[model samples]
Target: MDWKGRRQSGNIEDRRGVSPRGGNPFGRGGMRLPSGGMRVSGMSFKTIVFLGVIFLVLKLIGIDPLQILGADPGGVASEQSSPSSPRITEARKDEMTQFVATVLAETEDVWNGIMKSQGLEYPEPTLVLFSGAVRSACGNASAATGPFYCPGDQKLYIDLSFYDELAQRFHASGDFAQAYVLAHEVGHHVQNLIGVLPKFNQMRSSMSQSEVNKMSIRVELQADCFAGIWGHFTAQKGLLESGDLEEALNAAQQIGDDTLQRRTQGYVVPESFNHGTSAQRKEWFARGFDSGRLAACDTFNNPV
Candidate 1:
């Protein structure tokens, strides 16, 4: 994928080094609040780095540092680290940050056109980049939960470090593969916007665990198809190179529930599967890519 020099989304929230609860990440005693003063103790170099990152993030989000440290907002006065604060230039220019913003911009462009063609408007979703853990309207999630789209918040959350695991563990390394992952989450956002997610949630309220899991498979497969729709657009625009499709397919296969279960437990339980099998995922994506129509992505009406 030739994504360089491309438009980048302005909806990215770079919360990379902030703690999950928007507090000190260096554990207890690393930072302390004493009456009206902030105290620092036993801070290592890495801890200081994290503090700098947090300070930068808080300012970016417009949260007063003194208020966060338990001081009265009106009574406190200090030269705190902020966006204008000089220490944050390097962190803001991270390569992964640019890559995510670029991919999100592509999704926004493609989906906006797609939705408009159907006489609908696409409300672009925000993408939140975080490290370790983050909170969303849906819930708090750790990095172990993987990248996800929280419909409740209408946002996408990701830990860029997942790219390292995509290469090292999943063995699916390529720019397109990473794009596919991000697009798949954005696909969920599409589902949310179109009422598919709400209907699914309503249906799941009366469903058994197994039945809910089965419905989840359909949802997951449709997102895969939606991602393929994005790929179809990119390919037509000559942005996708040879082997890019293969990389995406390989990623889909590698992350399939069956593949993951077998790799982890040495066996697979079909009924326990939430996402589709490897073959099913690849097939649905191909269906969308080949047809380039939302009608082809009816994973719920037809057998997936």
Candidate 2:
């Protein structure tokens, strides 16, 4: 968790202020066309921000609502905010950006070594940092959709503000917990490279929602285990602090499908569970953290 002065990943795409619809966040008055002409996009600036809010209300959240008014939405904030979170200032966000880059660098180092050991070259994935909504080969996703890995483009997309929600809303704080989230997404990238995700995506069309959900649980659990594998090596590097392991476990528990369901709707629907139960998540992560071997992460072959 002592991440300062570490080598940050260079594969970051920062589009935090730009609208996914491809608007210039710095431009005022009217939105321009992709051609960069004086012609407007048939909407006023107020209308753009308004529709953006509508997008969020329909979804409940993304990273943060970019303050897109007379002020440049893309520009760094000159003011500072509180630890109340998600109210993150430009300075605070810069710090978080550095943290993310550092974590990605660590993952890159770990995966590069692991893949090399397996006689395969690891192609490092890009990390896309955006605000509100962003487009990927996977499709357009609001930050509300959360961080994701787009196998089509071999990139990781995130709105760093999601970490604030993790800390303040989910009560899952600590730098390691944040790292766990990104590492899990990167795990999907690993899965994609190893042919797991391609086969799953290809086969899901023939699957019923229930069957897909079941397979998805296995896939997600494996990713959690992979994150633990990363943690195992990171700990060996002596970068993890006291309680870091517990922090990740707590994060896994808090975000489990069962826990989220009970918290949101006051009931658990086993049929709807896709990411596994709290116990299952914690168990798989521990399995990988304890073993740190690819053989231990065979979620599909064994019962998860």
Candidate 3:
């Protein structure tokens, strides 16, 4: 991967230093006790009930008192920063952050051209960099949750430490593999733009758990295919080195639900597989790599 000195994305939100624990639990809501009881201090029982009534009334009218107070709900991580807040750590002395920005820029280039060819405008999604935990419009997540795309905010949340985990823990190491991860998440953003995710979210609630899992396999495999589509364009630019494609394929293989299940549990449950098996993932990615057309990456109708 000849990524050095390449164009970098400016759509990065760095929240590495912000503590997951914001402040004042009761400021938003009453304290949550260990025994599952609410504890409100400096207020009587009647006052607490009165406040609760007020909260309900505000909730019914779609107003949030906390927002009016200019504070995040539940004292969670916030986008707002202050001089008193924790200082954000600099981005890795120009290593991980630079690589991520370069890759994101490349994805933007590929997708922009493809979308324009289809007579559609591509809306670029922001990528967020966090350390331990971060908050999105969807919810809060820790680094252990891995990388994810939040349709609610049109942002991709990632903790760069996951790259090390990918290499050491998953045994799939390469710059291209890292790029594949980002591209896969960006593929989800593309799905969101094309209404695929909206349809899935709308229909999944009425589906059985097993049915949802099966559908999820299709969704994830399609993202893998989309990643490969990005790879195909990247290769045309003569950016891929020898074994670069294999690195991505191995990454797709290593993170497959079947492979992970076998690794962690020593057995595989086909019914519980949501992200497809190793062979399925690699196959879908290879399909997109071979044929860069959008029609080649459909995992919903055809076999995955």
Candidate ranking under TM-score, highest first, comes to 2, 1, 3
Our tally of clashes for model 1 stands at 0
lDDT of 1 by residue, 168-271 (tens): 77888999999988998899899998988888877876889899889888988999999999989988988998899999999988888888888777999999
Per residue, candidate 3 scores C-alpha lDDT tens digits across 117-172 of: 99999999999898767777666666666788877778887888788778887888
Question: Compared with the true structure, what per-residue lDDT tens digits does model 2 show for residues 89-135?
Answer: 65798899999999999999999999999999899999999877787
Query: Which regions of candidate 2 deviate over 4 angstroms?
Result: 22-88
Name the 10 consecutive residues with the lowest summed lDDT in model 3.
29-38
- Per-candidate Cα lDDT values, in order, are 0.80, 0.80, 0.80
Q: Which pairs clash inside model 2?
A: 62-144
